[model samples]
Target: MTVGFVGAGRIGEPMVERLLAAGHQVHVYARRADVLERLVAAGAKPVDEVRELATCDVVVSCLYSDAQVLEVLPAIVAELDGLLISHTTGRPGTLQRLGHAAIVEAPFSGTADAVRAGRLTVYLAGEPEQVATARWIISSYAGPVVATGGRGTAMRVKLINNLLLAAITQATLRGLAAGRAMGIDESVLLEALAVSSGGSTAARQMDARGGSENYLAAITPFLRKDLVACRDAAAEVGVDLSDLLAAAYDGPMNLGV
Candidate 1:
């Protein structure tokens, strides 16, 4: 398939690389020349403008935020007749608001490393035909393609997943802090947590970072972005998340002992 790619940031780059490796003709566009350099060298064509990608069979967006996606959507919508698979983790109603029939929500889970390793899980939601149209492109980089049904369903699932992720990470950090205050070695505490019911991907990440502070420093900004999106989505549906919001904001600072 001929694919157009936008936003070659950390995660985006790997996805594009995977598509290229899978024998797709990927045309990429980004403001940063440095981000595009490696991909261009690896046989992907570099387009100077977003509209140049109109000829592609599919255009995949992995932008950092909804704002960026919205900003780029007008240009993409004006030119492309093919499918738009958004990998941005944004609010539930975003893809619908774009007002394009060809657009589909395909929020993904996993880090850049996971993408390169082809271990990323994809949550897909759209009309049956649209979902079917995007499956080939999405499957190129992601592991299992989970169809959640309807445009916003996948985004809601991704947001909820991130909300639980934030809670788990915060809880793990607090547990480590409490263990340290009681004179338990951090490694030993992590080992016990690993063997106990408290074990989680977040706990494993904290162990990899050697503590809470480093992990928080590395991921807080991204986590905060997702948490804010989740809170807004919750508010739209009359759900209150005050306690979760407070804990998520406070945990990184106070719980990183």
Candidate 2:
């Protein structure tokens, strides 16, 4: 398949490399010349303009934020004759601004390392045919392509996923702190939880990163971005997220709630 891609950053660049290695003809674009050159060196064709993606079989935008997606994606869909798959995790309304192109809203879960390991999980939302076509292209890097009905639903699911993860992370951090107060080692507390019923991916991640401090430092920026997006999205729909948001903000991580 001939694929057009944008936003070759930490999360996106790995997907481009996987697509190229899967033998797809990938035309990549980035605002930065350095990013363009890096993707080009990874066997992707560099495109100067986003509109040049119109001629490809599929166009995928994995930009950093909803702001960037809003700024960049309308150009490709304006002339695009093929499916457009968005992997950015943000507001559902963000996708609505891209016009009536055949679009699959696929906000994925998992990290850049997950992409490199072919273990990324994608929440898919679109018309059936568009989603069916998107699964093939997305499978090059993603493990599971979970369908979530019509457009916008995938982002909603992703926001909930991030919000819940944040809550779990906060709860785990608080529990570990309590354990410390009780004279238990924080690291040992994490290790015990990894095998206990209280175990969570968030707790395991803290253990993986060596401790709470390093884990908090590493994920703070991305977690803050996702949590704020979740809060904003919930507010737009008039959904009360106070209970969840309170737990998320109650931790020591300082995610800028």
**For residues 1-257, could you state the per-residue lDDT of candidate 1 as single tens digits?**
79999988988998989999999999999788887888889989999889788788899998888888788877887877888999999888776777777888989888788898888999999889989878877677788889999888899898888878787887787888898899998788877776678788877766777765666777776777888788889999998878766666566443221
Regions more than 4 Å wrong, model 1:
253-257
Alpha-carbon lDDT of model 1:
0.82
Best by lDDT: 2
Highest-TM-score candidate? 2
Worst 10 residues of 1 by lDDT: 248-257
TM values, all candidates: 0.92, 0.92
Model 2 pairs whose backbones collide: none
Per-residue accuracy of model 2 over 1-257 as CA lDDT, tens digit each:
89999888888989999999899999988887777888888889988788898889999888878888888888888889899999988777878887866989989888888999999999999999999999989898998789999997898898888888888988898899899999999989999988889989888888988988888887777778888888888898899999998888787778876
Residue ranges of candidate 2 with Cα displaced over 4 Å: none
* Clash list (residue pairs), candidate 1: none
C-alpha lDDT of all candidate models, in order: 0.82, 0.87
Q: Determine the C-alpha RMSD for candidate 1 after optimal superposition of all C-alphas.
A: 2.5
